[model samples]
Target: MKNSFYLILIGCVLLACSTSKPEVVMVTKTIATKDTIRIANDSLDYEVIIIDAGFSSWLDSRAYPRKYHSLNYLESKNQLYVSEWNNRVLQPQLYNPNLYEMTINYDPMLRYGYEVNYLIYNYMIYFQNTNKQKLFGTVPTR
Candidate 1:
């Protein structure tokens, strides 16, 4: 009887020891590429190269539809938004004055295209994002 009790106790101890190991879990993180520009005690950062608020809106608008618009349609729509932003930049603006103040040279804004418009557009986006403020009137729903 004593030997049987010892055998059961040993079996129980072995079982407990066998099941006591902790599980190992592996986690993966995504690293995004961001671009940053610093000038004279000022810092600007952007996540994407493209920067038009209208283009951004159009980009978000495509998520639910999951369809691509024609190049003409996209260009025209984005151009409208870009022009609106350009006009706002020309006049006195209410939101995020630092963005305008820091880089408020409008002499080159005469030409309205991807390169010229997106430069200031990117600056506004970087300023807004860095400051963590939704100073812009429009917010993308998606």
Candidate 2:
């Protein structure tokens, strides 16, 4: 009787262990999209592809010397450069009053996409970094 009870207990333990829940796995899906812009000059038109969505903000954050320029000065300088780049590169009809306000329209249908914005955004950054001057002039450090 003792042996039979032990055998029964062992069988029950084995069954319980075998009946444990199965492991679960989860997967996420991602999709990639592409955008491009055409910039026209007097003699030629150029096509530019944009890949990074955060290019505009990133350009703003990195354009001027953080150690030298205050937050307000940095922002002002970025805006000045953007305005000049816009007049030089983008289609004139696409220029919007909202630009100087720093409230650009990113909708591909309405204005342009990440790429177009970044193209000009980076252009301004390059111009500022190389010239060490804003499009208009230098900002007062405080």
Cα-based lDDT for every prediction: 0.32, 0.35
Q: What TM-score does structure 1 among the candidates reach? A: 0.30
Clashing pairs in 2: none
Clash counts for all predictions = 0, 0
Say which candidate scores most in lDDT: 2
Q: For model 2, where is the 10-residue window of minimal lDDT?
A: 101-110
Error at 89, model 2, angstroms: 12
Compute each candidate's TM-score over C-alphas.
0.30, 0.26
Q: Over the stretch 67-138, how does candidate 1's per-residue lDDT look in tens digits?
A: 233434434444444445445545555644333322122222122223323332433444345445443466
lDDT of 2 at 10: 27
lDDT of 2: 0.35
- Model 1 misses residue 65 by how many Å? 8.8
**Among these predicted structures, which one has the highest TM-score?**
1
